[model samples]
Target: MQKKSCGFFSRASELQRAPFINLPLHTGRAPAYLVRRMIRMSHAMSKVIIDEYGQVEFLRRLSDPLWFQAFGCVLGFDWHSSGVTTVVSGVLKQALKLDVHGISIAGGKGKKSTSAKTDILLLAENFGLSSAKIDSLLYANRMAAKVDTAAVQDGYSLYHHVILFDKCGNWAVVQQGMNAENGMARRYHWFSDNVQNFVREPHTGIISEKKNPCALDMTAAQSQENQKVCVDLAKSDTNNLKSSVYRLAARDTLDRWLGGDMVVDVVNTSGYEMPRRLDWALFKRIYDVQPGSYEELLSIPGVGGATVRALSLIAELIYGAKASWSDPVKYSFAHGGKDGVPYPIARKVYDESIRYLYGAIEGAEIEREERTDALKKLASFTTRMFPGQ
Candidate 1:
């Protein structure tokens, strides 16, 4: 994913307020018969949403992590498994015909995900998109992946990425990352209409049940100073940065530097350790480029999580500009219930989504029995979500 700057929406506050939902990793392919039904259902529902609300609104809804999860449930996928992201996205890619829906999906699971740029090129030809607009779309796709994988170091290695976009250039991203050790997956969401900055708290939502207490979140607002310091360090003499890194590494622990006699145990040191070695070649390239902003620094071809971590540590210990170690996950597990365990459900909005989805299912051209089964599943999902409601 090559990087380029693109205009993003300036609704930071609204994006920050969006809800997140989790899905645990599950093995095995979804049955073929079930996938057929999901495709049909997704097509019908997507048509209804686009027809009634326009393509932009459809993108917005898909960007909502909660609604996306609920949509997967309504379409008969496992409501709490990681497959919801890949399956639902794959179904939509097949379901939404560009000529009919004015929307297209690019990228997918595993190896398929790497062809997003090629897919976007072919798909956008039908829409008569300009080269610049197409580049922006690609930039959005790459930067979202970069931010999630590099800027937010939560230990989830991304494997699935898809970008849903309309002829108008608006887009949303649904990508899933897995932590092989824990057998859990995290989903990241991005909407072109909800993001103003790519580097600072730009996600529409992030869904994960497990929160890494020591995750490095350079995207946090609190990390703004550290980001600046990182850029400055990257622009400064590489030898000076190297010396600082050596000094920090020479010390057995950063306990004194961090301003406390805190225990220098394995767990704590693991979070703050200077990388055993820095990529001097990459640093030399960064120096030559002299990136003016953290976003640009991240956009550099070779910069990844470990490099970002090393820079963040140097920024903190040497410059005293602390990077936030807090996990950016806003909610955990299922969407919040009525009593607000993780957070209160926005009932009116939730009901509106349910009503529209139900109406679409009722209006769909599928067989009566299939329709009945889908509605039953939707109802079962609702009951599980809010018991006794």
Candidate 2:
């Protein structure tokens, strides 16, 4: 995950939208030789960072998309590959000396992601974090994943998720989603420091190479009024909400709402259609809770993409409140590329990352030969990254 400069989509709007470049997924694993050294170098580098700046600062850096990308480059991974998100996080989970550093990472790709809560529990126990604080951390982890996958639909399905935190409870989430049809990946980032609301523009950064057409961003600040409408619908009578959902689901009603012919043409070409079923039971739970905010409404169990989208459309049709359908991504992720999908490798940024790590490794208490070998490996990487330079 990386942050592109704001120049790609300069806007003075209050939202301060970040660019997300779609990363086309490239196959193959990080080589064993590289993985081994990555763990060693990453462990050494992370120790140096934490010792100098403290735990919160270390997590803050990890949360920055560009810094995380540079970290991957320093570890010899493809600088622009989606694997950087997973492999770098995996290495950190395995390499970080948590007992010494007082920080830990939990969750990962595929089946590993399911164990995030348990991992959080174990880490909390290790840090002696209170049950309430542990519960809050777990909720943050779950909601971040949910909001990205369910609330923000950009045609990508999340396949990897990770959360990093320290004993003091400052935390960050880095997760990636894949659009298998196009082989493109998008990574969403969350930092506790920037999250004032779990559902409203909570992401510290969102990265993709291209903006997804017709994608819905319920988290955008533009959706604030729509979010309120959706909450009001949730608190309204379940019977009326069901009737509204059914009307929106019906093809005839859609044709009427879309002004007839345009609806069919658009739906036929873009495969854009409203959800057929609404979870009325979920609506009942929402009504029972009578959530005061959209974030609280979204936090309820079983309130997923369909539920959110249905309410958004109904809110638009009945109350004339429109949610932002514009995708948050303006362009691709930052720095450079491995295959140069967006542009050639960013030589300066890559070189600087190597120099920083080289200095850190040299200053560590590791063997002198080890430090020399690390620098040699980095030099070789630099040569490969830019043959002429």
Candidate 3:
């Protein structure tokens, strides 16, 4: 992501009002310029986004929750706030207690769907679209693609997910999502199976607030039925997040980036320092590395087209193994959602989301001080809920 000099939406209307609001931060760390490296790098951001090392230092200062609130204002209170992207980029730092800078970022574009089909010209008959092009389509902004191209500093076609965070300079695929149009559910079998097993076995992690065994009790079987919602969602074809380039990197490459960034300091929270180099071997040992064997890799937890691409790249380039870059899933923006909507955009979820946000903001304003962090965030969300509003 690029660091942008976010000119305030307006100069005089800055006093905490409406969506583009501000807060009277009693305290804030150094000037944003001081930690220029840590700001969010968006495909659309034209400014010089901070690099990995600079991001680590910037996060150290944001470790204060009060600073978070204060900075939230300085950056504009909108989630789309110029600062929101930057803040989110570093927020994980505070919560995770790790420096993400210096981490290598990587991921692969599984497949591309274009009107054109070209298998005739290429020697090996590679498909028409490259992962990079797919990335352009998905990210639309090209921030990740730019970062990968710039930071890779190498000739080995990045072989993991299209995105990977190279923390400590060691690139590893920690989490990856598939993009193939049809196989995601089947590919995520590892997760599905494990969760299934977890439910079948004794689970101490989920504690109920029950006073009596029979008090408002649901049979274990029935409770498992309710838990199946997540399982069902995991398999859901509706607006799934599996193909997101960012999500793929966040999941697969998060550990690699976690350590290099000094994450905890970024969020002002106390937690273990993000580990140095997650054990990719752990995954490797448990799962077979059938490079380009999308069907096999998809069965592993956290494995997706991105993971397959990363592994295949490593296997082929680094280890001298050959693999294919065919997209793993069919690309679709709508996924399984209605072409338009079950209800019109002006009437359906859009209206509902706005009403809910407005009511929530109004209620908070009425119940407590009109100016609260909650209200500020609500305002931010509302702007997104109703763009022109």
Candidate 4:
């Protein structure tokens, strides 16, 4: 089912209003000329946004998937291109110098991501944030990446991650992952303000060009039951969970447990057959720690996708607590829909977004026509996304 959704781009119902990572595929680097221009325009834009709305508002808009996409488009990048994420983040890193803007972007594509902790430390020192606060922010960055990469088994391996924050400690994350087979990339966004539970519904938005039907979304609200069961199973004796995995390894036992009618869907969606054996060693370690919640279980090292999936299945099949198999795709933009499928667009909210972007361009060093053209592009993007009444 995940393969079906991922193999092609498809529209989901607009009413669901769930967050999803934007997944789009376009390779190669943006031309040097374009990149340089983006950096200049983005820098000007950031200054205006921060000046008008304050720093927190700037971070909030960046955390928004639709606003982020539109910002990239306004800077002249392809609207649906995967490079939008990498280029926008990269340009921001270069353009938004902390001393000048009071906000800093740490980390980058691939190997650069490893420097996030170091960068955060330096920024923390400059900002005069205490060790506790800095450590907390650092932990937030690590856990956010870990949950997306390992907890969500959506077949995308994260290669690009960046965290943007102000000196006041507010932060947002924009990260992208690539699926080797399909050559598609999915981007995930996180805002510290919006994160209630890191393990469940923690994204500001996820805008993927395609949805994965069988994607194991343990964070889905419907999976709340399964999450509880998984925590219990983790705390229970390792031998019990190991036995269930052993049962899954045997075709006869699996068939008996699933029954004839239920076998196909379970096998296809769960990948029950592929993970032939359990990592009992890791399970023993988990057993020792006995995590009190699903979030903690996910945070533990070695608690990768296979381990999580297996636990979910056992919880569902044996304990009758099922995880959500439904796709959590919501096609929403910055202002939302005027008709109110997800939510009605407020005039004040919409105007404020435009005001900031417009102000940024107006204040930029660009010529009169460039500023006018930039505003026109933003207007067109808004109209196309949400037509007026």
Highest lDDT, which number? 1
lDDT of 3 at 273: 19
Candidate lDDT scores, in order, read 0.79, 0.73, 0.26, 0.75
TM-score of each model, paired residue for residue: 0.88, 0.80, 0.23, 0.85
Clashes by residue pair, model 2: 20-207, 20-208, 21-208, 21-209, 21-331, 21-332, 22-208, 22-209, 22-210, 209-332
| Model 2 Cα lDDT, one tens digit per residue, 1-389 | 22333213333341122222225697878889888988887888888878877888778677666567656776667766888899999999988877767789999998998789999998889889988889889999989988987889888898899999888789999999998887778888888987988877787667666665688889988888999999998999987876675455463533422332112111111244566455556677789999999888888888888788778877876677877888875332244534453466665655545555666667666667767765665665555433444
Q: Write the per-residue lDDT of candidate 1 for residues 240-281, one digit (tens) a residue.
A: 877676566565454333222221111124446444445677
lDDT by residue for model 4 over 152-246, one digit each (tens)? 77778889999988777899998988888777887788889888899887887676666675777788888999999999988889767666654
The stretch of ten residues in a row with the least summed lDDT in candidate 2 is 261-270
Best prediction by TM-score: 1
RMSD of each: 7.6, 6.9, 23.9, 6.4
What is candidate 3's lDDT per residue for 1-389, written digit by digit as tens?
11111111223432233122221112234356523422321110111112322433332223222222333432334332223323433433232222323322222222421111221112112223355443322331122222222211111122112221212212111112221332121000011111222223211111111111111111133333332332232333322312222233443433333442112111110121122232344344323443332222233345332333333232333233333221111111101112222222233423433343334334321324333544565555544323444
lDDT of 2 at 45: 80
Alpha-carbon shift of residue 35 in model 2 (angstroms): 1.4
Candidate 4's displacement at residue 365, Å, is 3.8
Cα error of candidate 4 at position 285, Å: 1.3
Distance from true position, residue 23, model 3, in Å? 19
Estimate the TM-score for candidate 2. 0.80
Candidate 4 residue-wise lDDT at 244 = 67
